[model samples]
Target: MPQGSSKKRERQYEHVKDSAKKRGASESRAKEIAARTVNKERARSGESKQASKTSTQDKKSASQRGGERSHSGSQGPTKDQLYAEAKKRNIEGRSSMNKQQLAKALGR
Candidate 1:
């Protein structure tokens, strides 16, 4: 037989709602996470009707902005660690450099 009407699905969905209410995750939060996941999947699919070039640029700029906040509120690397990475990478003139300077130099 064909799949039954959505009545069963709706009942199961109600159970899903009850279970979520019993737990701490709210339905709104679930929907927000789901929306973000769907957007990510759509980007990966590379089949959107919009201009691919524009979306590609948008993604690049958004990721660059994210990187700017990635290292905040943390101790970050130690001086010895910096020396080691600089040495490994053969980044010259690091003896007189600071961490931000080292990062910029090594980035190149």
Candidate 2:
């Protein structure tokens, strides 16, 4: 890290310490904030990963719902429908994506 950036972080830490002291924060409370601010970043990232897993599960259920609603003449969504789903989720270049590409883009 650059010297200036390191100093900036030290300043931020000092500010947090001062604020905690001024507000009569418990040691535990201060430690909790400290953990969330720095040491727990990885834990927060893990939470986002779990959220993406739930999203994948949700997509699976939604696709199944479409499957259940198909009439005799009406078929389940085709590749185009999957691409549309990708577009709805703001996937990049969804129009150009095939079914497998759409699925990968949607997951990410």
Measured by lDDT, the strongest candidate is 1
Candidate 2 regions exceeding 4 Å error are: 1-77
lDDT against the true structure, per candidate, is 0.58, 0.55
lDDT of 1 by residue, 53-75 (tens): 44444544445577654675767
Model 1 whole-model lDDT (C-alpha atoms):
0.58
What are the RMSDs of all candidates, in order?
A: 10.7, 18.3
Candidate 1: residue 11 Cα off by (Å): 51
Estimate, for each residue in 32-105, the C-alpha lDDT of model 2 and write its tens digit. 55434432222233423233343433333434577653466744467877877877877778777777777677
- Listed in order, each prediction's TM-score against the native is 0.30, 0.27
In TM-score terms, candidate 1 sits at: 0.30
lDDT of 1 at 3: 40
- State the weakest 10-residue window (summed lDDT) of model 1: 1-10
lDDT of 1 at 97: 92
